[model samples]
Target chain A: MTMATVQTPPKISAQGVNVFYGDTHAVDNVSLDLYQDEVTALIGPSGCGKSTFLRCLNRMNDTIADCRVSGQILLDDEDIYASQIDVVQLRARVGMVFQKPNPFPKSIYDNVAYGPRIHGLADTREDLDEIVAVSLEKAGLWDEVKDRLDHLGTTLSGGQQQRLCIARAIAIDPEVILMDEPCSALDPIATAKVEALIEELKGGYAIILVTHSMQQAARISQKTAFFHLGQLIEFGDTTQIFTSPTSGRTRDYITGRLV
Target chain B: MTSLPNLKKRWGRPQVQRRLRRRYIYERIFRMLGLAAIGVAGLALATLIVSVGKNAFGGFVQTSIDVDIYLNPEDLRPSSARYRHDFAERVESADMRKLLADALERQFPDIDTDSERRRALQLFSLQARRTLRDYITATPEKIGQTVRMRLLASDDVDQVVKGNIDPRVPESDRRVKDKELAWLAALRADGRISRQLSTTFFTGGDSREPEIAGIFGAIIGSVLTLLVTLLTAFPIGTLAAIYLEEFSPQNRLTAFIEVNINNLAAVPSIVFGLLGLSLFLSILELPRSSPLVGGLTLALMTLPTIIIASRASLRAVPQGLRTAAQGLGASPMQVVFHHVVPSAMPGILTGTIIGLSRGLGETAPLLMIGMVAFVVSTPNALTDAATVLPVQIFLWADSPERAFVEKTSAAILVLLGFLLAVNALAVWLRQRFEVHIPD
Candidate 1:
């Protein structure tokens, strides 16, 4: 590798994380570093534990009654998996976007304002409206929905709803944002819009994107990691990984020979 | 194989066409059967309403006698010192029966015999004394002017006017004597008797005399009972349902409780009556025949229904909403109160109203608590001895008097009206406030 990398302390770091659902070992020992102000994409096949690991960052797996997680995840050098850590504050700091565009049954203004209002981020109506407007602008949806802020969030188109969810996640000013196949339910045109939004959102917050589209990872992500059969195979710069992957499985997956 | 020729042969087969025709015929038969079942139920309900309505209409117009009551100065201003001290004693001590008898004598001066006086007195209602007392108390100044007032007719006389006595029947078989019938006909001819609207039926209280009995007492009792039941059942049932559906861990104990609640819903309603008799009436020593005890008993009976309905509505809230709220850093309680409960509110209200209707019409539960009493005055408080509509109807239906049959049917109609009103309100609320989420 001829490129000189700028070294910095990781924004979030995982050490020997393992996840189990009842008796099934869904994710075996895996560790990785997510850098600050960079978009890191996790590319993998189905059932490859990419989504599971992404959920671990904010402890989203705790919602599942049967799920169990044992390992250490640290955000800003603070251990997130500690028993004394409040999951509500953890989720507020690290927000998530589901694969499906699941907006709440509320007006667009309220949907975006929900997180901030719940966290007491705004003290007045003007403050809440300003927060909502700014979050929507950041998600690249303000121009389209600004005139009809009172419209129901569910009435929006698929792509707009996905962007609305992104706006909702950033409304609380989360430090890290996790996205799980956000474009899987959208068409190519909408997918292009979200990919562009991700590019624009790159430097403001740490982003961990789990996607099945390799071209998505290559086009928008700066660093990429490949996972297979519950194991992290390779991690490097997106350009280097796409051109000269160090692992044979990553090569096979990139070349479409593994299928 | 000759594939093209074989396909052509199968396409043109007569047996396949015949099978398709038979299948269509069977589908028609099943559709007709389903429609027939629904039509049968609708027809039965229509028949019941029509029959009850026809019988209830007779009770709306009551037979009344416009008697000329002479206010004897001696009767109104009694000569006793106690009468001067207590005005109620003056009205009460006045011999209204003797006054009515004297009025009857003046109306028919030719009837001078002892038997004639007894038969003439029978034309007046058993409640005629109280009616005179009330009039004397209300308008004491008019007593000496000999005012004409409409008093409730006797039950037998009311039955005769309603055409239920069957004048063609033998004299011995009828409760109305020949003499009384002749007096009724003479009164009708003289324009002294008329079919006036039964305003008393709506305003007066329960009575042994069907002519004077009214549904006001029972209606008020039902309102208080349902209010108490709703106050007790709705919050407890809804909270329990939320806990069971949204917060409870799916463990053996929870499963056992769920099964037990379902089983409790199927328990006979009368068993709940017995439980109330023991727990509320006997153990707690609450006032017997009071709306409080009756309401508490019916609340226990209605709890399972409300819980089941509330849980169903809570379950109908999409799981996605819960996730969305949690992803926004809302706590577990917030996830439920902010999203799931709001979405489930309409369903819960509808279910609660339906359950309350069941409690409103319940008679057996109230019966076990001695609510089937002869309440003469309308209950003004929930703790007073009261009878609900269903219990009043039961008491009237058991009476041997022919007029009571009509009163019983009228009470049923009122009860049905109340239930329909409650259900309509529920439907209106559901449509107005229910949140519709896009799929």
Candidate 2:
């Protein structure tokens, strides 16, 4: 594994965050930092709470009716849930993608315009068109879907749909983008395309990705966080986390002895 | 690429053909039975159409004679002495039937004092007398002239053309007395007993006398009630469903509401009628036979349907879409109203329409609130006492007169027409809004 040579304040930070649904504690207390212009990955076995903790970063857990979270989650060094903070505005700053592609049942153009339209980001039609174009280009979906902007978003292929969702997320112009197993549902070729797009996206946006693939974390992440049984076992430079994990659980997870 | 990994490749033969086992004869029988079930449904529909068509077609013909409807100035005024406090009060004591009988005796000397004379007057509908009184009260200027009027005959005369009245049977064997038969014979001799198109059947109010019954008022009542029901129920039910499904947190209170909604759906509509009778008619003191009361009852009936359907539509919107909206920084309200609802509209509309159509045909609940009543004039407002289509049919069905059987069938046809029209609209909207999520 290789390592990146850079130093910057994290774009977001979490401190002792734990998530629970009713009586079930899905994510135990965990802390981590996501830096600007760097790709961070969360990886472990199926029940390691990697996805649960990733959701904690952007407050996606708020959508669950029973899911509750305690502990501070900070964006730009400000408490996200402070009385003065607006969740709507906060979400615009931190976007997300999921394992399964779910595009709005509307045209490709409209899907891209949804977030911007809701938040009043684009003032004119031309401005909206520009956002759509740039976001699609960044997602590597523009060339394939350029001619059919009015076509239904759900009509695209599975891989294309995943990229379309990415484009939609980026169209909101967020500072950080989180992907939860974005390539798990795609084939190898699609995964490689998404991997390349992620590498390019780091230049413009901070990224916190959750995946079950160790090789993928090794291939794309600058810093890696390993979770096991609802705990953040270890987090550091991606190479060190893989080669010299400080915790036994982290080492066990890396070597496939525990998850 | 894949140089060392490109291992061995051997051509494999196609797998052996499996044995073809024949299915049991019972399988074929069950399949045929399924088709037969569809046939049974078709047969039921056909039978209903045929029966209603035969009966309703009989109601449009008039069996009455043209008689002189005089505004006998002296008879209409009732001596002018002991009158003039109010025209209605003055006219209330005036009798149109006595005037008609006296005119008949004076006009036709051949008619005797026996059943023969009485049978001759039987052709005139009892309601025709009320019409005469109303006409004079509305227009008092027709005071000395003998205005000609088309009078509706009795139900027995209607039976003659409809095949219920037998000409061969002796007077002693039939309901009509012997002398009345003589009057009918005389009318037949004079060609006064004729069958003409009964346009009044569609204009008059429902009555115990089948010959005078009309469904116009009831049809209008149903339309007005439905307008009120849809306007109120759809918005409230859909909004409640959206809030509960999309915004409300998981809690005991919301769950209690969810359970209550389900239970309310199963509650009898007559119970709703009781509620409306208590709440709107008595408690609120809205007028009886008013569309307002009917509408309130039907709205209660339709609320559960709309809520269930709207929730299903909301649930149909994948969680990923909401996440997508929130991912883009959309507020919870924006996510629901903008994307979730639009996707769910097709289902919501379909469910709403079905609920409305069911409301339209409902009878028991409306009956409980005094919607089934005899009203002669069309109501100008919801507060006016009026009857709906089903209530009109119910009124006519209970009439002992032979013609009411046909009137009931005609009213049924009109109600069915309304249901069909509403159902068609539902189907069209459902198709228009359906968004098939592709695999």
Candidate 3:
């Protein structure tokens, strides 16, 4: 497996990022660059700081009282950690899906329309309906939920709820989508559906997926980074990371020997 | 034969048999103890209800004696022609006791002696003269006409008729004399008496005479006070809860506030009354014995309850909803009001209702603020002199009249009924508004 190099400038660049929870350093300094329309998968064992790094991309760590992040993360040459950058606007441009299907306790239509309404992406009810329909269709959920748009989002099955959350995220037209094990709570069939959805979503958004399943990272992501003990060990093409990793630690993790 | 051998072998283990027997016996004892505890509580509640109901039943039906009153125009007119402007003023200025005694003497011809006349007058309520005066003042043209009015009987007569006082008891021991008993029996036999609903109990104001006294003023005072408490406590408690749970930084100061709020709930309610007296009355100089003062005191007492309950409900709301709203770029305020608050509303309201009920039952704080005063008129405004139901019960229970014992019990039942309504509303709101999410 060989690395496929792209000369275009990176969409999001992180340099020497470190995260701390109180006195415990949860995530050590790491540097990486992600390009537009690419799926970058962060693979690690439990508590290996993959999810923490993903949260830092959108400033989600700010919600935790003791969590402290020290790093320089730039989106389109603008530092996101700058004092003038509002967290609300930062989250609007970088949407997130949690490990569990955390749909809002609202009607399906309302759930999908929430982001667009709050962001004022739609000016009228018709515009909102159109955005909701298009977003749901994009998430591959419109056909299953079209007849019952008013049904509560929580009443749906696990797979449909996850897709509904994806639809909700996409309704705001975010540039970056962060998934923290979005399919961990689903069955095999649901996982496959989410994987296909993520693959299709990479065409328009820079997607960063944190997954425990090595096979999922190889199948969906173009680039893969292996993390161990709060530190990034190796990063390269997904095929090279899976078939022939440069670092012995990454090789041991890929082979399920050092989990 | 093989199965029998295995069963015998298993049963032969001493440890297993002893453990099984001990567990069975322990289970039986635990079940019996639980049942006994429940039975004790149920019996206690039943005994209280029966005792209160028995005493209150008689209060619902009051005894009245019919009397024919004649208001002479000469007696009603000013004696020296001082020229009173209105009939109401003249009625107020006239000697009602003399007018009523003259009219009542016509009903009893044998009461020529002063002692007999006094005994006959003892059958009528002390407030009977005022009732006649009010009737005359209302209809001035009715003077000189014989108007038959059903007036409230005296406490002794009311008790005797209600079987609370035994007429067969010794004359010295019982308050009702033999002559009064005989007159009561004769009045009953002559169809000059009636037992009807105590409509006056729901309409009349507080009086020194228990037979004429009513809880109407206290009910109004309680309603007005509760309205003030709800308006003051609900919003403040909810906002405080939201700030503490959703917005406050987790530091020593916030932890101190949280712990103090919980401790405030456990503080004895009487201390709040003292606080109200000193803060609202002495320092603020609000009017004494008014619902405004009483309600403010009760609100202060209710605040801790509401805040604690609201915080619990706010904490009960799923953290996932807040994350979801925030993930969608909603500000912290939007996350709370649009998502967390809506999801926590049923719980918040249930807590608020419970707090309001506690305020309704509280008497000490209000008494500290001078709500124990005898309020003769229903309060027309927040600043008017007023009392609450529990204080009304305290006052009635302190009265020397036997009839007031029944009135006190009846007032307690009224208070319980109101509390039941409020709790029922809380349950209905929980059923209608609370969302049950599957895990």
Tell me the alpha-carbon RMSD of every candidate: 2.6, 6.5, 3.8
To one decimal place, how large is model 3's interface RMSD in Å?
A: 1.3
Sorted into a CAPRI-style docking class, model 2 comes out as: medium
Task: Choose the strongest candidate by DockQ.
Answer: 1
Q: Give DockQ per model, in order.
A: 0.69, 0.56, 0.64
Candidates 1 and 2 compared by lDDT, better number: 1
User: What lDDT tens digits, residue by residue, belong to model 2 across residues B1-439?
Assistant: 6466433332232221121223456678889999999999999999999999898888777687656656676776745556666777667778777667765665567777656456556757787677777877787777688776666677777677467767678767777666556666666687666777887777767666777777788888888999889999999999999999987876899999999999999999999989888888888888898998899889999999999989998898777777877888888788888878988899999889888998988998998898877776777798888888887787778877777888888788878888899988988988888775642
Q: TM-score-based ranking, best first?
A: 1, 3, 2
The 0-to-1 C-alpha lDDT of every candidate, in the order given, reads 0.89, 0.83, 0.89
What tens digits encode model 1's per-residue C-alpha lDDT throughout B166-263? Answer: 88888998898787888889889989887877888899889898888899999989999999999999999999999999999999999999999999
Structure candidate 1, residue pairs in collision? none
Badly placed stretches (over 4 Å) of model 3 are A1-5, B1-12, B68-106, B130-148
Candidate with the greatest lDDT versus the true structure? 1
Q: For every model in order, what is the iRMS?
A: 1.1, 1.5, 1.3
Task: Answer with 2 or 3, whichever has the higher TM-score.
Answer: 3
**By lDDT, highest first, what's the ranking?**
1, 3, 2
**Of the pair 2 and 3, which is ahead by DockQ?**
3
Question: For model 3, what is the alpha-carbon lDDT of residue B322?
Answer: 79
Clashing pairs in 3: none
